[model samples]
Target: MSSFKSYFSIIQVLLLFGYTGFFSCGAGAQQMASEVKEVKAPKLLFLNYTISKDTNGTYRATFINKVLTEGRLKDKTQRQPLSDAGDIVCIQYNDKNDVLDRSYIKNPLQPIVEYVNDDGNLEKRQLNLNSAQIAIKLQLQEATSSVRLFLIDASGNASTDLITTSIR
Candidate 1:
């Protein structure tokens, strides 16, 4: 009977700690979100390429690219699982609004690491070379927004394959 009572006490203590920890974590996350929300940065980042286009009318810019994003979360780190989250890849326009550079990059608010988690929260690891792609249009007066990519290295070697999407 004494052992049973001791075991029950241990369980009770554990429950108390667990509840405390849970509340503490929730409060921390809320604080973090508020702090990051004050920051000003692009919500979406992507890579785009100019595919085939009609050169006859002078509108000859078609691009293809990928976009990365963490929807609704001000902090990229506080994101849903990659698979569960919406499209991380995106297509966008260039900054200059001319000639559809098809090889433009934008700076991201933060870097991201490709990670899979069963906990439902998307895990992000900051890469070294952060970059983004965009497409620009001149004559038609259509320019898309900037798309940013997080590189794992300063030299971007590990991200070279990803960077390839920018090439013609």
Candidate 2:
């Protein structure tokens, strides 16, 4: 009977801690969302994107991003599991206005761990992946509003891929 009582007490304590932690985490996430609503770095980060263009000259850019958040909440030595929260931001422009400076990069964001060729194995994508892909959609003369995607790095550098889509 005494052992059962101890077990019950332990369970109650765990529940209390669990509830407290849950609320704390919820508040933290809400705070983060309010602080930065969109990503602003590392231009041309993309897994893949499809562009649908038409006449009339409308333009829009949409961004889909996953941020890497690391926390030492579990064991001090071991980090917590990753959090996968998707942030979607969109900007729009019409050919009638909003001219932007543009630059292009090919195969910009590499997200591969290793490659095996005639050589046994080659490690790859090291130091990269500071962020996930930002899906951008361009529509010209079609009246699309999505404009740009960006991210702020730890050093507070705003890395961005800029595009100019408007009438002209």
Candidate 3:
């Protein structure tokens, strides 16, 4: 009877701590989110950085298309897939969509671009010819505060909406 009572007591203690931690963690996350400013895809900005600063204060940037890796945007649930031979454009813009820099990826899957890896090393990478999506890197003159990217297919189907990659 004592062992059974001990087991029940331990379970009760675990449940108490687990539920308490879970609820508190959620509330804390919510509060932190509320404190932060609204931004479009903030995590993406940090991941695929649109800007970088060298040690000499010379800031440079690149539009590395990590999302369009496989050459096509497809959803199994969707009836039609957005993929073809056309172009993908990365447009850097100001707050009011003033175009700052425009980079195009034509014949995207057949590039000999000097890709800068995460370690800041330049590497020669090439995309296969049979790629469905546009795959290339575009070096920018300088980092901008925001970017809007879109793709247009040969069949005249464009990206449904603007892909805003911003740090504002």
* Candidate achieving the largest TM-score: 3
Clashing pairs in 3: 71-132, 71-133
Note the Cα lDDT for every prediction shown: 0.39, 0.38, 0.51
How do the residues 88-134 of candidate 1 rate in per-residue lDDT, one tens digit apiece?
A: 32223466523332222222323466787898777878653323333
Q: What is the lDDT of residue 122 in candidate 2?
A: 70
Query: Candidates 2 and 3: which is better by TM-score?
Result: 3
lDDT of 1 at 84: 19
Q: lDDT value for candidate 1? A: 0.39
Lowest-sum lDDT 10-residue window in model 2: 78-87
Write down the TM-score of every candidate: 0.25, 0.25, 0.30
Candidate 3 worst ten-residue window by lDDT = 68-77
Global CA lDDT of candidate 3, please?
Answer: 0.51
lDDT of 2 by residue, 1-168 (tens): 999999999999999999999999999999998998664322321223322223532222333332222222222221112112212222444444453322122222333466665778675643333233334322222343334433223343334333322222
Give the per-residue lDDT of model 3 (tens digit) for 85-157. 4445566676666777555444343556688899999999765443333333333223456665556556655
User: Where does candidate 3 stray beyond 4 Å?
Assistant: 1-84, 107-143, 155-162
